[model samples]
Target: MKRILFVLFCFAVTSSYSQNKISKNKKAIIASVEKHKQSLIKISDDIWALAETAFEEHQSSKILADYAESQGMTVERGVAGMPTAFVATYGSGKPVISVLGEFDALPGLSQKATPDKNPLKKGAPGHGCGHNMFGAASLGAAIAIKEQIEAGKIKGTVKFFGTPSEEKFFGKIWMVRAGLWDDVDVNISWHPSASIEADVQSSLALIDFKVEFFGQAAHASGDPWNGRSASDALELYTAGVNYYREHVKPTVRMHYHIQDGGQVVNVVPDYSRLWMRVRDTKRSGMLPVYERVMAMAEGAAILANVDYKVSLISGIYEVLPNREGGKIMQSNLELLGPIEYTDEEIAFGKGIQKATGKPEVGMDSKIKPLEPTREHPGGGSTDVGDVSWNVANINLGVTTAPKDTPWHSWAVVSCGGMSIGHKGMIYASKAMSMTMLDLFESPDLVDKVKKEYKERKGDEVYEAMIPDGPPPIDEVGN
Candidate 1:
């Protein structure tokens, strides 16, 4: 009789504890997120004003660090050897949840926030990728979680990673190499897009390199024979790449733009440069083809009689899917509800779409649930791929741009700087905060995710695709 009574008492105590934790979490996070919304807007506006480029986000880093310090978070600056990169942490315990933030802008996308495309400063940089919102939303989630921890409503840790150089440099890859994510249990991130959805598929592995050729210079009209045209070498290299494309795997993608094709036709150009990017579904599959491309560049230099050099800038591995993490994030997304656009916001999106000549309004009226099957691969590249291999990681996208506006465009930048973008930002923050709450409320879910991650990574070691060296922060300004 006494044993039976003790069992009943224990059950009642456990139930009461669970209920109290849930109630406290709900109250704490709701109040925290509400307080965080205004600060998120301010951070977004500040990033938009700075318009910092990849690897060189000095002002953006300062803004994030300042806000994080104000929240009483322990901040680590110049992380992973990148000057603009840092990690801010709060709370003290296991099951660490990380919210990744990017603050990089695209080059030559300068534009005003207007329906008609107008360059704010011709040839200047702009946040066409909506990273302004990206950083702010992630910061908002971190702040909300921090509040929950301070109120003694949660026992786990929350981290905010300020990742730089998403546009050119692979900032997260270096951080991964530096073992910054080793202690993290799971990482979550989101991007500005035309729709809201949790990504369940993988992304391509990518590498960027620069090819330069050196030759003798001479006057075109006076001594053409005395010069070796480096521009000719660049042209030959491009032709070789075009020819090599027909023989490579169908999944391989090679793209290049001439960075320097000589000074003037009047003088036989002495130097030329070409920036190249190579991507494939798998890193191993990409290596052989990348080698072939290098051989082609060498062949071109030999034929053109010009000295050539190839410099690998950065490389990132493909993302590994995390089913358990995806499910948790999807559930929180459902709780947060879909982004409801105001009549004015919808009118603005439509106007931008019309001006851009894209007729589709990709924004749906209802929130879409996570699909059961992974049918398509993520078409873009990210440094997060490197983090996914180390820990269970998943990313989400929220509609902040017009349908079919294409990333890194003036149209996307225009919307990102306006109120329509702020709405998306808030939605993402709420979703992330709720997702973290779910993790805090259900400890078994974290264990399941970690177990799955271990099973998936079985005997597979994460090797940084980038070389072991200093961060390529200098490349940010260029």
Candidate 2:
């Protein structure tokens, strides 16, 4: 009995010591985030105000890149043929830890930083997806890790990727083609959400392409028989897609935007253009649907007697979730505890919830239990999904908006520019930076993450789904 008691006592001592050490390590990162809290908030707010879209985030990109440079990190701009994309690195050597930072805003979601749905500028761009917070928090984490490396508390290089155009073009796809993440041992990423969790679930694989129809124009009233209407082809294509939607699996999603159909009612359109997107739970599942949909475009052209062309914009793989990494992140989240809110903040959250037609649940401040990786997780697509295929990615979600508040909407835009978003940004920075400390401190942890990545990837290879040539930087701006 005495021997067993001694064993238990020794185990307790070791476990307590280990816990204390981890607490100490995390404290440093928390302090680092606090020290730079104001600057990070300013950065996030500045980007939110700029509200630049996709490849046009010149001012937003400069703010982050310049800050990185000022902090003594080597900054590389115009990376992977993207004028707004950049890479910032600090420290040197093995186990390069990369963090992704997106700064692009969505078009036509402009809103003031208020609970009410007030557009800061009507019909202008805004940070509806909280990317302004995303970029600032990620960079803050990287800088914290850099400080650790400087102080000799952690080893290995820390890299920050200033990824742009996530909303439209998936800029990381081009960066992947350029082999930007080939050598990175691990990547840490986070998104603003209505609830906090260590994200270990996959996202939708998506394909984006444009289809154009060409036909001979004729006067609708006078020479109707002579008209081979491209608009007819466009209509038929959409009809076919809608009809075929019922036959598809529940995981499949298709969307299209008609860019052109006709100039006026009096003339038959000679040209029609549309942007079509298809998505599935996996890339393998998405390809067959994409092919079938493309074939429908040809069939529609045949029916309308119009010439058609399809242009590949880009595609992205679903995220390969790393449970090993998620476990580490979950521990950090539990250690940090739930985020606290003042009465004003809670009321602000409730106001957003009400405006968005959700229960006035305010903010979900608890640390959500790390969920089991879903075989078919239902969510939107991301360029970071491509990055996950390339490197072991640890993803996190922290609440920056009211509970159940609509994403990519004015409610998100409003919260993202205020103190609500700032608090979540700081929390995410501490969580991700603490996770990075683990990767730098423990080689075994990094190996476990990479092992999970390899097992999930199996023998399949990663290939960028974008067309050959430079990213459509100039085209997207127009």
Best-fitting candidate, scored by TM-score: 2
TM-score of model number 1: 0.92
User: Lowest-lDDT window of 10 residues in candidate 2?
Assistant: 14-23
* Candidate with best lDDT: 2
Clashing pairs for model 1 are none
For model 2, the superposed segments whose C-alpha errors exceed 4 Å read: 1-22
Any idea what lDDT model 2 has?
0.93
Q: Once superposed on the true structure, which residue ranges of model 1 sit more than 4 Å away at CA? A: 1-24, 360-362, 372-378
In the range 118-204, model 2's lDDT, one tens digit per residue, is 998899999999999999999999999999999998889999999999999999999999999988999999999999999999999
lDDT of 1 at 223: 91
Collision count for each candidate, in order? 0, 0
How far off is model 1, as Cα RMSD? 8.3
